[model samples]
Target: MDLYFLGTGAGLPSKRRNVTSIALRLHDERGTFWLIDCGEATQHKILSSPLSLSKLEHIFITHLHGDHIFGLPGLLGSRGFQAGEKPLVIYGPRGLEQFVETTIRLSETHLPYRLWVSVIDGGVIFDDEQMTVTCRQLNHGIPSYGYRFEEKPKRGKLRQTLLQEQGIPAGPIYGKLKEGHDVALDDGRVLRSADYLAPPTPGRVVTILGDTRPCDSAEELAEGADVLVHEATYAASEWERAQNHHHSTATDAARTAANAGVKQLVLTHVSARYDEEGEAKLLADAQAIFPATTLAHDHLIINVPRLPG
Candidate 1:
């Protein structure tokens, strides 16, 4: 799986970066894209990427902040105009339905496809055969949430060489072996699938947090994640300001990653004060606390491979 940062700035859009928005591309696995926090002008950001808005199947909003959800109405309307026939589901905190209904009513925007909105509390919001998504309440200025995306483990590959060595002809029986099924030959000899199958491959876990202060809930949600994407809205010198505004600094984000035992920490939602030349300081601050740390920028795509056991 991979994560595409459509916008990584904090508070508002700037010439170098846009507001908070991320697209979790799952096309190869599920043939759809999952969006997290659609900030202002998010659809415009997707236009610059290879992603198509029409393929967006799910949208998870963290809070009601303008910088986190101002682009929802426009994106929904544009998806219909762009020939999006598939159904779209949106999950968020309470009042999400009212917000979407009010915007569509006042603007008279018509959607071509069915729109499903779920305003839920902290729990598992979505689950299917392929993956599961869980949410927990976070400590923010408002009622915010953090999400954890866990992919289901898949069966191991069949040992073709072992089967060939046993004089077993390869055909539809290979599919059965891969599915962990035993086959019986005409001579009354039973061949067990476990004897010719490798161990199951582990799934990948990715955690994404919205605007919030450093809290235990964030750490719990990001426990042992392959990649943790947290908002670093300030520098280490602004610790007081970060606490007052319920935002996290680079050091705060790294500390959370270290506590959660995440393999890699991605610092996003950067403040506008830091220019291109000042980015190194941010990375250094985070790396000083946690060695596996990196700063995220606009249009930055991160490929998270499966973790080694």
Candidate 2:
């Protein structure tokens, strides 16, 4: 899986960054992508990136903040032209449904596809055969939330070499065995799939949080995640300011990652007040707490690979 950062700035847009928007590309897994948050002018950011609105499947909003949701109406309206009759689902905090309905109604925008908005209440919001998504409310001075995307464990690889050694040729039977099914051959030999397969591969966990201060709920949602995308709106030196604004500092984000045992931590939602040197200091602060930390910028893509079974 790959995380494409479209806008990594906080509160407002700047020369180096836009607002808060992230595209979790799942092309290899589901042939579609999901938006974590739709900040102001998010569609414009997507236009400059390698993303298409036609493939957008779901949108998850963190809060009702303008920077986190101002682009929702525009993106939804534009999707009707590019996505044809594709259905879209949006999940967010309370009042989201009303906001979407009001905006679409007031603008007199007609959509060609069906759109569904779900109010998030902190729990497993999505669960399918391939994955599950859980949410928890965070301390953002508002009704904000964080999401945990957990991929289901995949079946083990087929032991092609072992099958070949047993004089079995590749065919439809291979497909069944790969799916952990037992099959009987024409010669009346029963081949157990477990005997001809490797151990099941473990799925990956990705945690993406909305704007928030350092809180226990954030750490719980990020526990043992393979990739934790946490907001670092200030450097460690601005801890008081960060706390006052209900935002996390770089050190705060890193501390959560270290406590959660996440494999990697990505610090985003940067404040526009920082220059190149200040941004470097933010990275340094985070790295001092958690070594596997990455300071995100616009267009930065983080590739997360699966773990061995």
Candidate 3:
């Protein structure tokens, strides 16, 4: 899986960065991508990338803030123009449904696809064959949420050599075995998949948070995550302002990443005041606390590698 950062600025857009939007691409795994937050001009940012609106199936909103959702209506409408007719699911706070419905209704827009909007608090919001998603309230000015994307563990490869040596020809039975299901041979021999397959492969975990202060809930939500995407809207020197705004400084984000034992930390939603020089300071400050840190910028892509067997 890979992430494409369509916009990564905080509050508003700047010459150096756009607003907050991210695309989690899973073309190889599921032939689609899940979007996280749709800030202003998010669709425009996607248009500059290789992402396709037709491939976007899910949108996870962190809050109702203008910077986080202003582009949603435009993106939703663009999907129809692109001939996208697949169902789309959106998970967000209470005002999400109303906001989308109001936008579509007022614009008199007709969507050719089904839009499933969920007003979620905190819990497992989505679970499917490949992944399970959970959310927790965050420490923000208003009600905000942090999302945890946990990929489901996959069954190990079937012992093809053993089956071939046993003269068991490969066919639909192999599919059953790969799915961890036992199969009965034509000769009435019961084949146990557990006995033939290796141990289950561990899945990857990714936690993406909205504008928030450094809190224990953030750490809990990111515990052992492979990648923790947190907003570092201020530099360490601006800690007081960050606290007042319920936002995290770069140092704050790094400390949380360290406490969570996350493998990597990607900082986004940066304050527009930070030019390239200030952004360097932000990145360096975070790295000083947690070495595995990177700053996310508009149109930047980060790939999440699979765990080694």
State the C-alpha lDDT per candidate. 0.92, 0.94, 0.93
Off by over 4 Å in 3: 167-172, 185-189
Model 3: per-residue lDDT, tens digit, 3-64?
89999999989988999999888899899999999999999988889999988889999999
Clashes within 3 Å, all models in order: 0, 0, 0
Runs of candidate 1 exceeding 4 Å displacement: 307-309
Number of the top candidate by lDDT? 2
Positional deviation of residue 113's Cα in model 1 after best superposition, in angstroms: 0.4
lDDT of 1: 0.92
C-alpha RMSD of each candidate structure in angstroms: 1.5, 1.5, 1.5
Among all windows of 10 consecutive residues in model 1, the one with the lowest summed lDDT is: 300-309
lDDT of 1 by residue, 130-153 (tens): 899999999999999999999988
lDDT of 3: 0.93
Clashing pairs in 2: none
Give TM per candidate: 0.96, 0.96, 0.96
